[model samples]
Target: MTEPIKIDVWSDIACPWCFIGKRKFEGGVAAFQADADAPEVIVEYHSYELSPDTPVDFEGSEIDFLAEHKGMPAEQLRGMLEQVTGVAAAVGLEYNFDILKHTNTVKAHQLLHYAKAQGIQLQAAERLFSAYFTEGRHLGRAEDLADLGAELGLDRADVLRSLNEDEYLPAVRADQAQAQQFGINGVPFFVIDGKYGVSGAQDPDTFAQVLQQVRSERAEEIPA
Candidate 1:
């Protein structure tokens, strides 16, 4: 039997490549788990805000957020979005820029905390990403977010009240502090086995190779 490895991923829903990274990482896990010699891998998703200052009710489109944040030309933003969308598509993801909704994800991260309590953090994360990216659903609204919790068997009223009371702010902050401690300056950063750090959404082959390496290292007998 292979030893288990921990994988901590720092990502945000507003990040296009984060979702892409999620898929790629999942593919890597699938490949590694199927390999006869591969080690066990446990994945934990952490929060990282890309647009922490994004307006809750911005009038402009999602692209406007990036342009304003970086002071980049609109044409340049368009080209960047197009290139990102192309990369997302290559990984079997559909990034609908036309219907994208940009908003502050702090509350969404709070909800992820609640979901984590229920052992559904990954599901809640995926729901929020799909809601904003593809479904054009507004996640900035508290009721809208609670609806997701209700679907996940969380108490709707509790979710609403938690949002109203600003719950899980500490967890969010702690994750941010951890990110800073690790010198993580980007989303989709992954840490494997609590010791190995992997930045970005590396190729599946890389994950497979890493899993193998970690397993082998675990098997080495030290001098007593």
Candidate 2:
């Protein structure tokens, strides 16, 4: 029996490009699945905060956050955001920057660890991205995270207890520490099979090609 290819993804709920990259990676997985020689794939998401210093409840728009935190001018930031919004739209993600709520994602990341233990990490991730980017829901608070977990059929009380007690905070920090060990300084970083690192929001074809190469190499390692 062959081992499944492991893909570790590091991303934050507040990251727009991470959501877009997720869609692209899904597309690549689907394309790989089309091949007769494709290997089984296992994907696991890790934690990486794009703005760890962001306040729990940021009092500003997306542009305002960038302008204040990143020192980017409003006019230039607007244009940059518009361009990224268009890119997100290309992959079927409607990025509502107008209603986007910028906040610290520590609780959200903790909730993800809870969801991962329940075997619904992907669902939880998609829910978080939608909540933050499209629905404009707040993800910084324990109650909001518990509510989001409930939406994915996770136990709300348990979610709240976990968040309140900081149950998964260690896991979240571990993921971040590992990211640093890998010298990863950005969100949406893809680590394939514990060796290859693909950074940023790359094209679907790029991921598909890399998967194919990994699969081929694995096949060659087996005894005839």
Candidate 3:
């Protein structure tokens, strides 16, 4: 049996592009899987906090947060967010930035790590992105995270205890350190087979092409 291709995706729950990219990547996977000769693919999500210093409960709109922290004009930020919202919509994601609660994602990242241990990281990632960008759920506090975990059928007490005790904090930090080593300064970065690095929220075609290329290269490396 051929080994499966492992894709390590570095992204944050607060990142709008990450969710869009995820949809595109899934599309690519579907396209690739249509071929009977296609290899198996495994996707793993990693933690990458965009704003580590953000307060757990931030006040004001997304624009206000950017204006205050990034020092960009509110008008420019609004335009950018509008464009992002449109892109997200194109990928079948509804991003409600107006009601988005900008908060520190450290706790959320830790939750992802916890989910990874339980073999449900993919579901956890989707829930978090939806909660943050679409549902406008608060992701910082332990109580809120515990509730979200419960919605996923995870043990609410265990989730709350994990968050409160920071059980997976070390794993989150380790992912961050690895991202730093890779010189990844942005979210939605894709590391394909630990060799090819595809940045940004690329189109489905782009992702499919990359996967095909990787498969071809691997095929050539094997003794015929």
* RMSD, every candidate, angstroms: 1.8, 0.9, 0.9
Best by lDDT: 3
For model 3, which pairs clash? Answer: none
What tens-digit string does per-residue lDDT give for candidate 1 at 1-224?
64578889899878787888888888888987786666667777787888788778878886787787788999998998899889888998878887887888888888988888779898888888888777888787789899988987889999999988888878988999999999999988988888777778778888777777777777785444
Candidate 3, lDDT over the whole model: 0.95
Assess each prediction's global lDDT (C-alpha) against the native.
0.83, 0.93, 0.95
lDDT of 2 by residue, 30-67 (tens): 99889776778899999999889999999989999999
TM-score, each model?
0.93, 0.98, 0.98
| Residue 136, model 3: Cα distance from true site in angstroms | 0.7
Residue range 125-168, candidate 3, lDDT tens digits: 99999999999999999999999999998999999999999999
